[model samples]
Target: MGDELRADQFRTEAASPRGFRQVYVREGVGGVPLLLVHGWPETKRIWWRNIAPLAAAGFEVIAPDLRGFGDSDVGPDGFHDVPSHARDLYALVRGHLGHERVVAVGGDLGGPVIQDLSLRFPGFVERMVLFNSPLPYDRERMAGLRTRPPREASDYFVPQGTDADALAAELATPEMRRRYIATFYTSRFWAHPGAFAPEEVDFMTEPFGDGAKLRASFGAYESTFSEAARSEPTAMACPNPTPTLVLFGPSDHVIYPDFDRMAAAVFPEHTGPFRLRDCGHFVQWEAAHALNSAVTAWCGDLLAGRRRQ
Candidate 1:
């Protein structure tokens, strides 16, 4: 991860038809551009380990601070739903990067964002990759959650989704907020225990040091409960046609078990729900070398015109 990363900023409109200011880092200037989207409890910097290798392998690696995370501006009046992020990404790739197509990859919240991108900009995506995320599963499976992990596993979701004002007040300062976000990197509920080194912890915590930004990350969960984000993907007239690749961490406690079924249902022609042994929800961080290798290889296959459109 030693390449000199370059930064670029685009107006919110440029990120999506209705998205906000996004700051992205790039590591190469040629080859098929790869758009990497980050997820919750972290920033684009989460890819710090994978980007250099992916770029050096000959792809333009572009990772952006998702709306309401990192230095990117919060979304429309704090509406940081998956649809909004997807739309912004569409704009970023089309209007800002001046490319009509890209090879897309995402994890965690990014999975949903990429799903929405496939929905909104159907022909623009050339290939897709996902990990540590969810597909649009049946409502019954969501109800099945009650039969799964102790509900306490999702206790954090309630406050972040509903009582955000109170949570923000509780984490009043940047340092205090960083400590709260740090829980994810160290908690069995999110990351594998002791997954981050002290320095890595600091790097992950630095962006949340902005109290306003920390508060903003909560809205994505909130959007799920809000009327804006509740529609089922089954309602789509068709499934996304883009060839897809999926990777997962076997030990994840956050994403419910049986996600592979949903992944298969959504992406019928997908590659793997390949498990990352001894890892958790943050597979990208925990399994960088394998992740980078798989993604680089997948991108290579895409560039070689081997994958379906």
Candidate 2:
């Protein structure tokens, strides 16, 4: 209850370069600097449940709405993409948070952005905590890819990934947009069953109600191939030096099951692909207590030099 009491104690701030005029929250006074990034179809509010535990663990927690989502400014057309998001995030951490090196935590699309930070802006991210996210599958990982029999494809990705115009117009209205975003919260193929209460569903989908926000969010998927390539030259020349803690949810339907396998080799200093039970895509939401515990423990161990990563 103490944590909850201090939950609203976060000091709110904003930065122009991040492309959002939205209010952002920063908590905790002193410790390791931590930046928490949220993924698509959701906002920084998703971090509400973890804020207290994480910030209480002795770290300045900076959580912000990604551009084009939540209360953030939705800029002009075709501007939101993965590489571009990384740029804004860099500014937010260095310019806003005043941290050159930080512990970055992310899930969903946020993971990719953090990954880019580590790759592009090396020495800036000391550690990473990623969950149920897409990781780069290089040669060995791809070769060893054990095709999970019935490769269930998403009817969603390509439409959003490739054809932006048609789908954007289709769900242009707020009501229609919310209706479409609702599917992810309810879809059996996605979230864990009974994962969302009615109010929670509305909260998660609220940001995507705007057409510009909804459309910009899709660019993440679209920029996947091109952006990942930006890091290949670096990856080959220099091994991934960032230590990563990968928390995985077996209940998640979309992400490949054995991604931790790919991640293990990819991130030279890596820990458990800690399999989480009774959770789905939104691991932090469905398993908040467990996620909080794991993150804090890792942070503690990391700071104590017990982990050496």
lDDT of 1 by residue, 1-309 (tens): 213222222222224445467877777756568888889888887887777787777777888888778878877655677777777777777777777788888888888888778767777877888776756655643454322434656788889988887999999888899888887787646766667776677778888988788887887877766775433331222255678888877667777676655565567668887888777777777998888888887777655652233
Instruction: Report the error of model 2 at residue 169, Å.
Output: 0.6
Error of 1 at 115 (Å): 0.7
**TM-score for each candidate, following the candidate numbering:** 0.85, 0.86
- Candidate 2: regions farther than 4 A off: 1-11, 18-22, 147-153, 225-239, 301-309
Query: What lDDT does the true structure give each of the candidates?
Result: 0.73, 0.73
lDDT of 1: 0.73
Give candidate 1's error at residue 240 in angstroms: 3.6
RMSD of 1: 4.4
Candidate 1, superposed: residue stretches over 4 Å from native: 1-19, 139-150, 228-239, 304-309
Candidate 1 similarity to native, TM-score: 0.85
Q: What's the distance in Å from true for residue 70, model 1?
A: 1.1
RMSD of each: 4.4, 4.2
Q: Give lDDT for model 2.
A: 0.73
Q: Report lDDT (Cα) of residue 102, candidate 1.
A: 86
